[model samples]
Target: MIALLNNLKTYLPFSLLDNKAFKRIEESAQIAYYPENTVLIEENEIPSTFFLIIKGIVESKDGEELIDIYHNDDVFGGIELIKNQPSAYQYKVNEELICYEIPKEVFLELCQKNSEFKNYFFSSIVERMDMLKERKESAKMADMMLTRVDDSILHSACIVDHTMPIIDAITKMENESAVALLVKNESGYGIVTDADLREYILHHEEKNLTIISQIQTYPIISVTEGELLFNVLLLMTGRSIKHLPVLNAEEEVIGLLELIDLLSHFANQSHIIHVQIEKATDLQSVIDASKRIDTMIKTLHLKGVKSRYIARLVSEMHKKMYAKLFELIFPHEWHDRCTLILLGSEGRGEQILKTDQDNGLIFEEGFEPKDQVEITLKFTETLDAIGFPRCKGNVMVINPKWAKSTTKYKEDIRRWITSPGNDDLMDMAIFFDTFAVAGKISIFKDLRDFLMEQIKQHKAFLPHFARSIESFESPLGLFSRFVSSDKGHKDEIDIKKGALFALIHGVRALALEHGIHKTNTTERIKALNDIGYMSKEDAGDLLETLEVINTLRLHSQLEKLEKEKEIDNYICLSTLSKLERDTLKEALKTVEEFKKVVSYHFHLSMVG
Candidate 1:
C-alpha cells in the first residue's frame, strides 16, 4: 500500500492530493493484474471500476479504429464513471498489465471528499493539466501573485497646500522623511519630488518665495490601490517617472509609490532596461537597449510573471523603441502626416519575441512628400537593422501598396470586400488587426470604422472569413493523442497552426461579425462573451487554452534562443513533461471545439 501511494504520487491529481487523502485512496484501491489482450472496459457498458495503469499499455478503440494508447500513470474510466454513462470506447490491455482498481462508489466518495481531486476531473483537461504543472511551482509564484502596490507603499505621503512656499514644502518633506509631496489646489492634486526641486534650482536663479504650485508637476500621474506591483513598475518605467500617488476608487490619494520602494519588492532588471531605452538618443543606443529584451523576458519568466503580462511589457518596450526610432529617422513634422501601423500579433499585443515585421503606413489623402519613397525605404531598412526582419510577403511600408493615402486604403478595403478571394481575404484579415503604434490613431480609427461597416453589410462574406478557421485541422488524434508533424521533425507539433491560429482567427471572425473592435484575442473573447455571442464558460476555456498554448510557444522560443538557433513554431513533444503533453492534448481539443462552434455559427458547410 505504501509503494502504491508512492507510485500514485508520481501522477497528476494524485500528486496534488493530501497525505490523508492518499491514504484513503490506498485503502480503497485494490490491486489487479491481467494478461495481454484482456478486455478491461467494453463500449456501451457502464463503467463499474476506475483503473489507474501501474505497468502496461492500454489501447482504447472506437469500434474498428484505434483512438488512443494509455501507458503507466494514466487513468482510465474517469469520464464514464463521472458522467454515469456507458463507456465511449473499449479499453484492452495491449501488454501484460498491473493496475489498481477502485470501485466506482469508492472513487465517487474520494471525489466528494477531495475538492482538488474533484476539480481535476471537472476542469477542462488542459486546465487540469495546467493546474497540476502550476502546483509544482505555486509556492514560488504565490508570493508574486499576491504582491500589490499597496503592500509596497512605505510612507504616508506629505501633503502641502498649493500656496505653500517651496522652502516650506521642502521642510515638510524633510520632517516627514518623504521623497514625494502631494500639493492640493483648486484644479486638483499634484506631486513634487526631489528631482523636480533639483531641476528647479538648476534652471532658475530666483531665491525669493517660489510657490509649490509654480514648481510642482501638474496633472499628477498615479496608480490605484491594490494594483499589481509588476504593472506599477511597467507604468513607471514606460512613463519614465519614479514617484506615483496611490489613489483609492473614490479618487482620494492613499499613499505614495517611490522607485526605491518597488526596488525592495522586486529585484527585476526589466525596469532598468526600460529606463535605458527611454534615455537612448541614437539608433545604436536603441540597439543596445533592444539586446537586453531577451534577457529581461527570461528573467521575468523565471520570476513567475504570467505570459500575457510579459507579452504586454515586451510590447510596451517595442513601442517605445519604435517611437524612438521614428523620432531619430523621420523629422517630427512627418509624424502627424502618416500613421505607423502594426499588423498581426504585434498589433494584437500578443508578440512575446521578435518576429518578422508586419507593418504598414497610412498617409493623409493626397499628402505625398517629395522624400516619401526614400523615407519609407529607410524606415523598413532601419527596422531590419534593428532585428525586425522584413516581411517576406512585402506587407510592409516599403511596398507602395501598403504605404498609401487614407483614401487609397479605403479603396483597397472596398475592393477586398466587393471581390473576396483567398489572397484578398487573408490581406483583409491581417489589416483588420491593425493598431496604430505611432501617429494620429484617429486616422486608423476612421479606416477601421469603414472596414467594419463594409463587413457588417456583407453578411455573405462571413462564411468565407470563417472558413479559414477550418483551414488548419486541430492536431489531435481521434482518441486525443497528439498528431505530430509529418514533414520536418516527427516528434514535433506546429502549435501555432494546431492551436493558436484556430483560436485567434475563430475569435477574430466572431469579433468582426459582432463589430467588436478589440484586437487582442483575450479581449475579443471577453467582448464576445459580454455580448452573448459566446457563453462565459466557453470564453474562459478559450482564453485559458490560448494562454497555455502561448506559454508553450514562448518557452520553446526561449529554448531555441538559448541554443543560438532560429525560433520557429514547431514544439518538440519529447522535451515536454508528461503533464505538459496531456495539457497540450487538451488545449488542442479546445481548439477543435472552438472551430466547430465557429463553423456551425457561420454555416460554413453551406458554402460552395
Candidate 2:
C-alpha cells in the first residue's frame, strides 16, 4: 500500500493530494487482473466499482461501436459513478490487464473528502491525464534582453532608389540621424550601414563609392517585427553587423533597428516608462510615452514576466495616461463631477496588448453639462491617437450610450437584471467588470453594490448568464485531439473561441456568484480557491492554464501583426513549436474540463 501510494503520488489529484487523503485510497484499494480480450463490464450495466489500470490496454465499446482505447495509468468507472448514471460502455481487456479495483463507497468517500480529486474524476476521462509541474518563476535579469523587434524602438529606415549615389545615402544618414539606408531593388531591398561605408572607405578609392548599390549588402539578414530582441542581438553580435533592417509581414524593409538604441532602451529601462508617464503634461508627450508600451509588453512577456503582473502594470500606465488626458481636456472641477471607468478585460486588469477602448464615463447624478459632450469626445479621440484603438462597438465615452450619469447607469443595470434582453444581459456582464481609473472612484463602487443587490434579488439570472460558456465548444474533441474548423480559417482555429472564451466567462460568472471583489481573472481564481469554491490544486492548474493561454494567444497575435495579416482571435497553429502545440492541446483539454464543471454548477445542462 505504501508503494502504491508513492506511485499514485506521481499522477495528478493523487500527486496534489494530502498524505492522509492518499492513505485512505491506498487502504481501501484491491489488486485485480484480467486476461487479453476479456469482457470486464457489460454495456448499460449499473456499475458500483472502479479500476485504475496498472498495465496493458483496455477497450470501451458501445453496442459493438468502439468508443476509445485506454492504456497504462488510465482509470475507468469513476465518471459514471460520479454522475450516478449506469455504465454507458462495455469495458474489456485489449491486452492482459492488471489493475486496482476500488468499491463505489470508497470512491464516494474520497470525492467527499477532497474536491480537487472529485473534480479530476468528475470531468471526462480525457481530463484525467497530464502531470502538474510547479510553475512559479519570475526574476528580472541584469539587462532587459527581452523585447519584440518592432516594439524595440525601430528607427524608420532612410529609403532611396537603387540609382542613388553612395554620397546621397551618407548625406541622408547624417541628416536624419539614421544608422542605415535601404536601397530599393528588383529582387528586394539592399542595405548599406555606416560600418559598410567605413569598410568601403578604407579599402576602395573615392570613385568606387559612386552608386549606393555598389556598396550595398545584398540578400540582407533581417529580423521580423515581433521576433525577440535577443535573437536580433545574437544575430548582430555573431555576424559582426551593426545595422539590421527590420521587415514587416510582407517582407518589406520598413525600418532600421540599431544596436545602440536597443542597448539604451534596456539601460535604466525599469524607471524609463514610468518616469515618462509622470512627466507628460501634454498630448504629444503622452503619445511619445504611450508608444513604448507594446515593446515593454513584448519584452516582459518574452522574459517570462507573469501575464497578471504585466496586466496590472499596463492598467496602471493606462490609468495614468487617461487621467492625464482627462485633466488636459476638461476643467479641474469637471473631474469632481465624473469618473472615467474601464469595462471588459481592462476593467478586470487582465488586458495585455492595447485592445480597443472598452471604457465609459460615470457622472454625478444630474451633472450633465452642455460642454461635457465636447470634452469627453476629445478625451476618447486623444486615447485613439495614443494607440488605444476606438471600440468598433462604440463602447467608448464618445458614444452617448456609455457616457451617462450614475443614477441613469444604475437605472439601466436594474432593468437589465430585472428583465434583461440579450444585449442588456451582455451589458450587465461588461459592467460587472467595471473599474474606476480616474475621478470619484466611489461612484464606481456604488454602482457595483447596486448591481450585486439586484443580483441577490434576482438569483435566477446567473444560469442564463453562464449559458454563453456553451456558446462555442472548446477546440478539442472528446478523444483529446485538435479539432479545427471546416468553415473559414479552416487550417487555423479561433484559439480565443476554443480555449479562452469558456474559461474566461465561466470564471467571470463564478466570481460574480461569490461576490469576489477582485476582477482580475488570476486573482479571482485565487480568491475562489481561498474561499474553498475550488481546491488548491485545481486553482493552481487553472491559473497556470490561464497564463499559458494568454501567452500563447499573444504570441499568435504578434505573428499575425508581423505578417500584416488581419489580426483577429484566429491562431495559425502551423507556426507553433512542438512543445507549444502540446501545451496548447493540454490547455484546451483543461478548458473542456472547466466547461463541464461550470455546466453542472450552473445547471446549464437544464438551463433551456
Pairs of residues clashing in candidate 1: none
Question: Candidate 1, which segments miss by more than 4 Å at Cα?
Answer: 1-68, 71-268
TM-scores for candidates 1 onward, in order = 0.66, 0.59
Clashes of each: 0, 1
- Tens-digit lDDT string for candidate 2 (64-132): 777666666667888888888878899989999888888899888888888877887654422332223
Q: Rate the local accuracy (lDDT) of all candidates.
A: 0.80, 0.76
Q: After superposition, how far is residue 506 of candidate 2 from its true place, in Å?
A: 1.0
Q: Distance (Å) between predicted and true CA of 71, model 2?
A: 22
lDDT of 1 by residue, 367-478 (tens): 7766878887888877777677677788888888888899988888888888788888888889989888887778889999999999888888878887888777777876
